[model samples]
Target: MGSPKRGHHHDLYQIEASLKEILSLLSEVEIDHKVLFLNADAGFDSENLRQMLEKEKIISNIKTNLRNNKTAKNYYYFDEELYKRRFNIEKANAWLDSFKALFIR
Candidate 1:
C-alpha cells in the first residue's frame, strides 16, 4: 500500500537504490567472479543505467522494451541462463501474492 507517489520516481532513482541493496548483500558474501553481470528487468533499463554499468565495467544484462531500443544493435546483451532466473523470481513473487492470510495489513 506504500507505493511511491506517482511523479517522484524515475528509472535512475529506483535503480540506484536497488543497486546499493545488491552491493550491500554482496559485501556479506565471498564470490569468485571478478566481472559481475547485473541483470535488471525492463523498468530499470535506461541510458543512464547503461552508462553506469559500462563505466563500472560490469556486464549489463538488462531486458529491453520498445522505448529503450529502437534497433537490435542498440539492445543490451542478455545471458539466457541468468535472465531466465529473473522471471523465476518474479513468478515466485506472484505465487506468494495469492496468500491473503500472510498480509496482515
Candidate 2:
C-alpha cells in the first residue's frame, strides 16, 4: 500500500481500517502463517503501520527512506537480500510500459 503524498491530507486511520479488513479476510481463509513483506516506494513510511504489523506478529520487511528527520531508535531486522529483489518490481513496471496499451488514453 502506498502512503498519501506529502502535503496531501489523508487519514491514516482509514488506511489502518482497510488493512485490518484485508487481514481479517486473509485470516478467514485459514492463512495463519504468512510472511507479508511490504515494500513501499519511499513514500509509505509510517511507524504506525510497522507497529501494527509487529502487534499482529506478522513478519514484515518494509522499506523506509532515511531522508526524514525521524530516526529508528530500536534495533529492527531487515533482509538486505530481499530488499535487493525489489528492483524486479521496477523491471516489471518497465516491461509493462513497453506495451502500448498502458500508454494509450
- TM-scores for the candidates: 0.55, 0.58
Candidate number of the best lDDT:
1
lDDT of 2 by residue, 1-105 (tens): 233345755445466776787787777887774566665544555677778877877776766557642566644566778878889987998788788776685
Which 10 residues in a row give candidate 1 its minimum summed lDDT? Answer: 1-10
User: What does the lDDT read for residue 58 in candidate 1?
Assistant: 73
Model 2 spans with C-alpha error above 4 angstroms: 1-13, 33-35, 69-72, 89-105
Query: What are the Cα lDDT values of the candidates?
Result: 0.69, 0.66
Number of clashing residue pairs, candidate 2:
0
